[model samples]
Target chain A: MPADLTRRKLIWGGLGAAAAAYAGALGYPVYRYLADPAEEAAELAKVTEMELPEEELPAAGSATILQFGARKAILIRHDDDTMVCFSAVCTHLGCTVAYQADQDRIYCACHGGVYDPRTGQNVSGPPPRPLEEFNVERLDGKVVIRRA
Target chain B: MWRGSMAKSSSAGLSALGARVWNWCDERLALSSIWAIAEKKTVPLHRHTFWYFWGGISLLLFIVQAITGVLLLIYYRPGPEAYDSVRSITYDIQFGWFVRSLHSWAANLMVFAVFVHMFSVAFMKAYRRPREFGWWTGLALMGLVLVFGFSGYLLPWDELSYFATAVGLEIPRSLPGVGALIANIVQGGPEVSTVTVQRFFALHVFVLPLVFMGILGVHLALIMKHGSAVPPSEEARPERERRSIPFFPNFATQDLVMWLICFNVLCVMAFVFPWQLGKPADPLASAPEGIHPEWYFMSQFQVLKVLGEWIPGYLGEILGIGLFTLGGVLWGLLPLYDNTSQSGVRARHATWLALIALIGLLALTIWGYAGL
Candidate 1:
């Protein structure tokens, strides 16, 4: 090949090779970065259970907040010895709901959203859906809250 | 004789198959003509040729933003969960931190690249005559990109973004007639709430991207139609003295090299200085001290602050907003104001004006950072 043609080939070839190498180096991490997080699958199978002594439970008609991993749950005890728990995050906007003993409903201060404590149903507010209910079991003198 | 005949028959069969494929494609599309045009394309080489890469850099950053933004969307939840979800993505999700950081860093760099591209084009006076529409589209893209930055800033739902957005939304209220209306639309109500966040999220993810893609298509088409503008100085030279290079392999290779360098820089920045979440937003709390908008908005923010101090009340805000709007209008109509034919003494006034504006912005940015 002529000198000029050979020089052009070398320059173009080098650029092409360098570009490919750079892309490969950067693209691998980018592909991994864009992939679905492994935690999503792990979370699908995650089940968390926390037990509190029966004495720690709030009195009848009252409720207390429980920490579950990075989430919060409100535990309400009834006069009939039945206990109920619901995720504290309001369905409308995810604000932490507080149990109002006098009104006997869970209330979100952010937007006047209300949910029935017993059923976790949207009572009368901007909330579009009921608060999420958690499984509660009373065993061995303790209340166990199971979250999936 | 039989073996030779069989070989000839198979070769003819292969040729027939290729012809059929070509005919099938040709029936639906005219790829040959497109290729011919592409082969004929050339980019002028001159002293200011390096500046041309900024447009490509901006486009690359935008692609990065789009990809990373989509990745972030998978884990991001709007509304009150936004803050925690962002935190979870940063801390819990695997490689989420890297993706989120890359997205944020690329967004900032994209804005920077766009500004540089705009300024470079302005100085080159490339917006003359037939390129006026191109200039308008470019200006529109700049506005869209700023909107992109503003909307994306609020997605993290962190303290800085939250307060900054609140202030940003307030600026529209300074418009004379429909000011409050615009602000209301942006906020989705009288106050910034879940609705505001949702509205911003929609604008950032769906609405803006579609609009940007449309405008970008037009912009690229216009660039190809008119080819790259030769700097006025180069245009002034005799035809024999002006040199050119083919777009393929030559200019394209150089563009690829610059892109690689930019990619490396982005990676280093994303990894070295991962974007911080700041503090989670507290709606009930007052705006914190030293709270300001993103760096791109710093100059305007500083102007508002100084104006507020000097003039007092809504008057100052109105004046500041009015001035900013006027500047934007003038910038969008730059081609109309500058009718110069080429660069040199003739272009000095426009060039000096651009320089002064740049210096003024830099000074304001520094002053804003100094909290004065």
Candidate 2:
């Protein structure tokens, strides 16, 4: 029986080695969950901040284009006089999105992504994430955007 | 003796007959006895990489989704009013928050894990030739997963959910020939009304799960049939290389371990986040600007919008969407034509596809952030 076991072991030794690796591999992600967020934050520390001036935004039913942080967000005055701000990146392929004044949506030229100007909801195209929101608030007569 | 026993059993009548019928199935059919599949079979003992377990984790999450969903079902209704019932499961049902969190986070992670698995498979090129069905099934599962996300989003009945779901219904409207029909059926009208919520709720909890389960069965079967993605030999066989683990005690045991770990992680999440119920979807109030679908759909969502605008409005929307859906199908089926029988690169296709997908994802993420 011992000899037979040895023979069997020889045949399946490679398989066993691989299985051990599989078990080890499973351990790695668990490790990452332990390590990831902190590591990611450190990297994020390198990112710079940007701001937008409010007067640049057009009146009600008007739109303005501005770049903030490492990306772009569009500022618009809706019919209600309240200011709405959205990122200018298309959700589909990450193309630089443009504001479509006529259609009231953000447009991506690369793949035809269209986002609602009012809500930044994807109107059309393949962008997945909604246009990101910028932290902007009214101060006096000006709307200010915080950095990434 | 057999005849005598059979006659005696029959004399005992159908109550005894039912027990007899049940006993006839035997010890091997018992779930506890399934370990027999591994008893004498060879189970490779090599290790696996961390990434490989994402699929297993994803499956675990699905199981959580199933369990929590069923538990929630005790309280959940199917109509617009049904949403409150779902909400009550969290607020009313004992430990409902745990269950709801399990369901929500698990569903989200399942999608994430599917992406990871799919990309990993692509990086490994597991879709080659005989394994093409696996790839196709996986692709279909991906679509269904998005549907899961889409439908589940509406179940929350939040304003973001309402508008996001509305956007979800609209994406399909550009599907060329069947655009309007598909849109109407899914949306239940030209707009997202009570009917739309009802439809999304039904699909989230019922219809899509049935479809997803079927495809998942096919996907797992294919994985077992073809074996895990093989690693390149130049690196002295990846520490995680093992093709033939008995699906029982060996691989199955490992799978159980993985699930336990994932559950632990989910436990932390449920305790931490506990399935946030944002303000009940406000139809009257407009969504705050910069509303986005969850991360998973961002790439295609971004891509489709771009394509629609570039082409003539009417024509572009149709072709853009039609092409996008077809493109996904084509991507899944690509391995059918990629002959690797003699290709020495050996299982590199999956890894390559994973890389390409990552690139596309990265590019889109940048754009998504840019709101390009």
Per-residue lDDT tens digits for candidate 2, residues A19-128, read 68966754553354334445656666445444445556677877776755445667777778877777766767667777666776678889887787767788667777
Tens-digit per-residue lDDT, B1-372, candidate 2: 656776778666656666776667654468335445446454344343555677788788887788778866665676667558667766755566666787788888888889888776675555666778887888888888877877887876767788888787776776667977989987888878778878777778779999999999999887765656553331355455534556556766777788777787877887798887767776678877888888877877777667766864777666656766675665766676454744455335544655676898779767876883
Model 1 DockQ (Cα-based): 0.25
The runs of at least 3 residues in candidate 2 whose Cα sits more than 4 Å from the true structure, single-residue gaps closed, are A1-148, B1-37, B40-51, B232-248, B305-323, B344-353, B370-372
lDDT (C-alpha, whole model) for all candidates? 0.87, 0.71
- TM-score, predicted candidate 2 vs. hidden true structure: 0.60
For model 1, how big is the iRMS in angstroms? 1.9
**Model 2 chain B: ten consecutive residues of lowest lDDT:** B230-239
Compared to the true structure, candidate 1 yields what TM-score?
Answer: 0.74
